[model samples]
Target: MKYYSTNAKAPLATLHEAVVKGLASDSGLYMPEYLYKLSADFFDSIQNLPFNEIAKIVATAFFGEDVEQKALDEIVDDTLQFDCPVVEVSDNIYSLELFHGPTLAFKDVGGRFMARLLQYFIRKEGKEEVNVLVATSGDTGSAVANGFLGVDGIHVYVLYPKGKVSKIQESQFTTLGKNITAIEVNGVFDDCQALVKKAFMDEELNRHMKLTSANSINVARFLPQSFYYFNAYARMKAAGKADNLVVCVPSGNFGNITAGLFGREMGLPIKRFIAANNANDVFFKYLQTGKYTPMASIQTIANAMDVGNPSNFARVYDMFDGDLQKIRSVVSGATYSDEQIRETMKSCFDSNGYILDPHGACGYRALEEGLTDGETGVFLETAHPAKFKETVESAIGAEVEIPERLAAFMRGEKKSVEMSADFDSFKNFLMTR
Candidate 1:
């Protein structure tokens, strides 16, 4: 399979080049020149195959002969070391638990897969060194940091909003010292994202450093996310309850929802998608008005979705050929305030004994608001509730137990440098590093 930039300027590239370049020279996300749809028989066959087998089939289809079968198998083994459990939260609502991985967040699938793929690519091309630049609001930094930690020939630099992320989220990135460096920006997530994008576009920087990205903008980051969507369908089929299903995703950068749409295009039996958002509701407004107007993002308890201008929305738009009607037909979007998120968390716990973090609660609220309309809606619980312990405990009047992974985080020492959001400051930091 060959990949081309959606901007139509860059030449078609192999999967290795697409993974390494991240964004195209024309500043577009890379997409396959052609998408190969999976047959219905293949979807039916997934129920019998192990998760790793299913991943290999999907990976080989997109990556072709670039990644060896043995290397691809190792990639799947390392990436999917957790379960994506679909727990019934009520009569009509279900919560897909996606926090069982090492970093206890859904980004683990994409981050880990990207790291392994990069390692394989570097080995094949005989590159001596590579640098991965990423920006995150919460879970992404830790997932990327942990995924690429101590990997030979690669270094990861993560930038996050200072004092905005949860304590645990901050610790996850800052605690890892070797080959992973964390920088705290004094602005919002958009500011951090802008710095990373600018670095990729800098010609001088590219000459001296091979700059890659682990953010959702990378095709590598988007591809592995399609696995869990198929996994969810497989689980439902095993229970003999397979039907038209709608997935409620707490979308910030819009990567997860875009991947789900990709799965639907690949023959997954999905009815629709709900793009749940916090106060920074640019996506919600775009779904309603067909015009994307970005503004300053507001800080909410669901800090991850606090992106005013999501980079992956460009991919979503490209998927629909800039046709608003078609986009609306396949995807629905809604926004919730901090108060609504808290209320939904309390109600879900009281009524169904499910503890949801603030981000997932936004998804539950979106489902409750009738956006899904009685469909078998599965709201994605993207992070462990312990990630937002204070909010969950105060709203539910109880404590959320920390997992062993997070308990270990408490003992790790945090190491990070604070910097202004100016581009010159970021450039200076990169030069010194």
Candidate 2:
């Protein structure tokens, strides 16, 4: 399938090109030219299908024509070796636990899928050493780093804001010595993201080193995230709780929610979406006043949702055909303060005995406030609570035993290049190295 840029200036690109090029030449995010809707029969059988089986069906819609079914299925299977089960937290709200992966974050699915798909294209095209430039608030760095770790022909550079990421989150990327390099930027998440974008658009740097983004601006990373939404719907369908189902996503750069919106376009039977926000509430403010405004990000316990100027807002705008009213009708917005997130996290633990990472707390709270009677809600518990060890422990006043996976990460010494957020410093670092 062909893809078009949200900016509407770049020529349409094939799926492979969109995956490799990441951001369009016009500095716009790439979107599919057409959304392939699933058949009624597929939804009818969705309840019985395994996670990878259902993932293959959905992945085929965007990638089947471009990739052979066998190869595509293998990619889907490899990407989804872990489970994403929906657990009932209450009578009306269910938590789609997505942290059962190597990185203990929901971005693992997208990161792994993108890694395999990009590697396939690299081998097919006989390209040499494509450097992946990714900026993470918290989880994206670890997810992308671990997903692409030791994969041939691709080197990943994870740029994250210094001191903003959790200790385990930073360790997951920084500890891996080969093929993954972590750059600690002395700024916020947006600054790190800006450095990635500037490097992509830099003519001199592009000539010296082949660069692409693993951020959600890349079609490969964001589109594969739609898998969880389908899986969530299928599970809900099986339980006969699909009626008036609302899916709540913790929003940051808006990539995750944008992918869910794609699932809705493909007839996923979702009633609506709730874009949950932390301190960086640009989208929430937009939903309130119907005006788009961006500012600096504020630090919150839910660090992953701290994007002031989300890169993928353009994609969501394009997805609904630039119709604000149409967008508002299908999706709702809610914001939570650090205090509210803490309260929700503590309350859920006290009530349901379920631990929530700060990001998941925002999602769960949004559903609690927004969902009406008879409307069952599924909030995405985006990561394992132990990933945010200190914050979660402080909120709940309980010691969380570190899992073996996280303990392994914590044991390694940190190794990261420190840099200012300036593009010149970033560009010079890339050009020199």
Candidate 3:
């Protein structure tokens, strides 16, 4: 149950240290020392259990050594109140609808799970305060903000790129006035992420406040994402289509897909995976060439996948011992342009009466092109279509009715401080205010 830094420079840490610290002192992501594979009987009975029931077993397998059975049960129950159902989108391709939670995105599982787990740690240790810093290109801000809202002894600061996120995405976090503060960063997501990483490493900031990240870089945040993949497999199994199963995830910070890979390693019976990318295709290019080179990100309709230098890539590299052929055997890549995303969204709507948000469109298109015969592909519909109302409407030539939750959020008054993406400015703001 011990976690080690992917960089292999920091001391080995307990699950508590890894979750609370968020990032290593050496600026590396923390990963579990060893992954525990599930038993065959577990998978045999998984298809018959409820979503939360399946989650409890899987969560226990990963976190049981670190957390007590009763406490872990409560955490899994609190986190998985919502369901993720796999809906057939094409003949052999399905879309795992992961947007049924409060924030209507896949990250809700991680955000809520992390919030509960962190609060458990806080209450047990009598910590005065813990501040969560999260960077988002889109859905993560809302998911984290809503997840941590009003939690005792915790404050959340959501840093999102100005004008890059959808209005609904921005509103969901910025309007939450208590315990959650949204900062409109005058730069891209990479800048916001850099600021968080720097703040975690800065001695002055650490002295002033307990700093941890809710970004995928945090094991507490991303490891719970494995719950989503397991739930998807369970659902597929119930439908009697578990054989030759392939999961496709829309990759941004690479947390979602990496969690899926973890599930595969844990004997999830998944045949392979597809990391669908938008215009910011650094990971895709790396999968193609076996050389990872980070660059500045470009804006795309699938804004959530717009990360240039994914922090979780380090964990992915470490998980497979930096073996390219090993990664390629179970995982593949596909990149799409904004035009292609629009086209796929339109086509899905026209052909099947199914609406896809831009991010899911990339996943759907990738699965459509990549799935071979006798394989059933399940692409993650990571967010609700209504989240990107305007863009989706334009693409499908039909109106997207805003969900009640999103509509309420949009009506709330915005209340975030505008700040430059500079580390000094961010640090000073935190120290001064």
Candidate 4:
């Protein structure tokens, strides 16, 4: 399967090349030149298969012969060591709990899989080493840092918005040493993402360091994320509840929702995808008005989705052949304010006895507002509520227990370098690292 840039200027590339190059020379997100739709039989075959087997089928569609089935199985087995539990929060409304991984966020699945896939590609090409440059609003940094930490031939540098991420989220990336390094940008998530994109486009930097990305902009990150959509569907099928289902995803950079669309293309029986976003909802506005205008990101409790202009919009637009009407038909976008998010959290707890973080609350709100009757919707609990304990507890009037894994992290020392969002500062830091 060859991939082409959405900008239509760069040459088509195989999956490995797309993974390695990340952003195309034209500064466009890499999309498959052709998408092979899965047949009904293909979906039925994996309905009862193990997670690893299902992952192989889903992954091989994009990876093709570049990655062997055995290799893909190992990568899946290693990456998905935890469960993505689907719990019923209310009647016909379920929460896909995706925070059971090392980083306690949904990005762990993609981050870990991308790290392993990159390792495989580097080995196949006989490359000595590669450096992964990632930008995170909150979860991606820790997920990338932990996933590639201590890998033999890869080093990860994570850039995050300073004073924007949660304390635990910050500690998760900054505390890890060895192959992982964290740089705090004195700006929003967009600034950090812009710097990373600029670095990838910088030919001089490419000569000095083989720059790869673990951001959602990377095809590697997007492909592995498609697996969980199938995983959730399979689980629903086993319980005799699989039908036209809606997935409510908390949109940040829009990569998560785009991957869900890929799964839908690969024969997943999804009715519609709801792009749940915070106050800075560029996609929401674009879906409503058919006009795309990016503004500066606004601060919100759901800081991850605080992207004013998501970098993954290029991929989303490309998926629909740049047709705004086609995108609007399949996707229903909604944005929630901080006050609305808190109210949604309170209502969900008071009504269903379930706890939700701000991001999950945004998804829940979208589902409550936009869900059609008889349509089953699953809101993605992207992060554990305990990750935002202060907010969750204050809203619900109760204390949430921290997971044992996160407890260990609270005691670790944090080590991160603070820098301005200037290219020179980032470049100088990379040179020293």
Candidate 5:
């Protein structure tokens, strides 16, 4: 299927071009030309299939025209090595646990899927080395860095705000010394994201080396996220709790929630969506006032959602044809302060014996407040709480055990190149490399 630029200024691009280019020439995120809705029979029997099987059906719908059946199946199998299970957090409220992957964060699905898809295209076309530029507030760096680690003919550059990410998150990316390079930017996550966007738009940098982004701006990265939404729906359906199904996402760059929106378009039967935010509530404010105003991000315990200007907002706006009423009808927004996030985390653990990462806390609180009668809400538990050990411990007032996989990352020695968030500095660094 062809993909069009959200800006509508660029020519139509094939799946290959969309996947490799990452961003449209017009500096807008890519959107699929058409959405392939699932058949009614598929949804009826969806619960019987395994996670990867459900994903393959969805992946084929989105990619079958471009990718061969066998190859696409292989990619789906390789990418989803872990399951995102739906666990009960409370009555009529479930948590889609998405932290069971290698990096133990939600982006693992997109990160790993993008890595394999890019590698497939590179190998198929015999293309030269492709450089992946990803800016992470926290988990994205680790997820993308580790996803492309040691892959042949590809190098991943992870730019992250210095001293802003959790120590565990930092260790996950900075320690990987293979094809992954972590850049510690002396600025906020927004500045790091700006540097990436500028690098993509710079002609000199493009000429110096092929550049693409793994951020949600890339169709390859975010589109695969819809897989789990289908899987989550199937799980809910199996549990007979699919009625008035509401999915809440702890949104940051808005890629995660945008993917969910796409699933709804493909007829996933999601009743509606709630975008949960921390203090950096640009999207939240936009929902309230129907005005989008980007500002500098504010740091909170849920650092992953610390996006001041979510890049995927362009895709969301374009998807809804710039209609605020249409967007509002399908999606709602909620914001929480750090104090609220902490309180929700503590209260949930106290009552349900379920620990939530700070990001997930925002989603849980939103569902708790926003769910109407007869609605079953599923908030995405986007990351493992152990990723934020200190913060979780303080909130729950108990020791949090670090998973062995995360503990292994902590043991690896840190290695990173410190750079300013200035575009010139980033350009020179890339050119020099």
Candidate 6:
């Protein structure tokens, strides 16, 4: 499949080139040239199909032309070892529990898929060491780090804001030493993201060493995320609640929602979407006034959604052809403060006895206010609440049991490199490495 840059200036890239280059030469996010719509038969029998089957069908649409059927199926099977079950939280409302994977977050699917796909290409082309640069606020670092951990011929560098991520989130990435290196940037999530983008754009750095991003800006990383959307729809259809299905995503870099939008274009039977945001409400403001405005990020309990200038806004804008009204018609926006997030978490636990991570709280609360009668709402419970144990326990006045997976990470000692947010400093560090 041919992939084009959203910027429209860079040359079109093949699947291998797009996955390797990550960002286009024009500094635009790569998007597939065509979207393959699923057959009516697929949707008709979707309720009977398992998650792996649903994901394989969707993955085939995105990658079948470039990759062999056996390889693609293996990648899908390996990536989705766990299911994203849709559990009912209240009447007409459900939570798509996506934290059942190895990293205990929704990103595990994308992160693992990207890692395996990249390794496939590396082996195919006989390439030398490929460095993966990923910037994360919370869960993404751990997901990508653990996904690429100890994988031969690839090294992952996780750049995260210092003192901004949860302790558990930090431990997940920083504790892993093999092939995964954590860099603590002395700034916000946006700064770390900027460093990754700049490194991709730097001529000398790219020439010196092969650098690719594991962030959602990469086509491979974001496109596979569409798999879960199809899987979620299949589960909802099985439960006889597929009519007027509204999926709420807690927005950060906007990649997750963009992937869902791609699914919608490919005929995923989604009624609409809601992008829930924290205090950093740039996308919310854009939905309100039809003006795209970005600002500095604010530190909140939902740290993952704290991206102020989301990198994937380019893809979202390009996907809608920069039509604000059309984008608004399909997708709505909602924003909440830290206090509001806490209130939602506390209230949901008190009322439904369902614990929500701060990020998922934004999604659940958005559905609570946005869903109309007869519309089935499925909000993404993006991560395990135990990852944010302190905040969740304080909000609900109860202790959260740390999962054994998370406890293992906490048990490991942290090892990381500290760096400033300056692009030059980042560039120099990479050039030396």
- Clashing pairs counted in every model: 0, 0, 0, 0, 0, 0
Task: List where candidate 3 sits over 4 angstroms from the true fold.
Answer: none
* Candidate 5 residue lDDT tens string, 354-391: 99999999999999999999999999999999999999
- Note the residue pairs that clash in candidate 6: none
lDDT of 2 by residue, 116-202 (tens): 999999988899899999999999999999999989999999999999999989999999989998999999999999998988788
lDDT (0 to 1) per candidate: 0.87, 0.92, 0.92, 0.88, 0.94, 0.94
Clashing pairs in 3: none
Model 5: how far residue 94 lies from native, Å = 0.5
Off by over 4 Å in 1: 371-374
Worst 10 residues of 5 by lDDT: 28-37
Please provide, for model 1 over 69-151, each residue's C-alpha lDDT reduced to its tens digit, 9 standing for 90 to 100.
Answer: 88888889988877888888876677888998888999989999999899988988899788999999999999999999989
Compared with the true structure, model 5 gives a TM-score of 0.99
106: Cα error in model 3, Å: 0.6
Clashes of 4: 0
lDDT of 1: 0.87
Root-mean-square deviation per candidate: 1.3, 0.8, 0.8, 1.2, 0.7, 0.7
379, model 6: CA deviation in Å? Answer: 0.1
Error of 6 at 223 (Å): 0.7
Once model 5 is optimally superposed onto the true structure by TM-score, how far is the C-alpha of residue 387 displaced, in angstroms?
0.5
Q: Can you give the lDDT of residue 113 in candidate 1?
A: 93
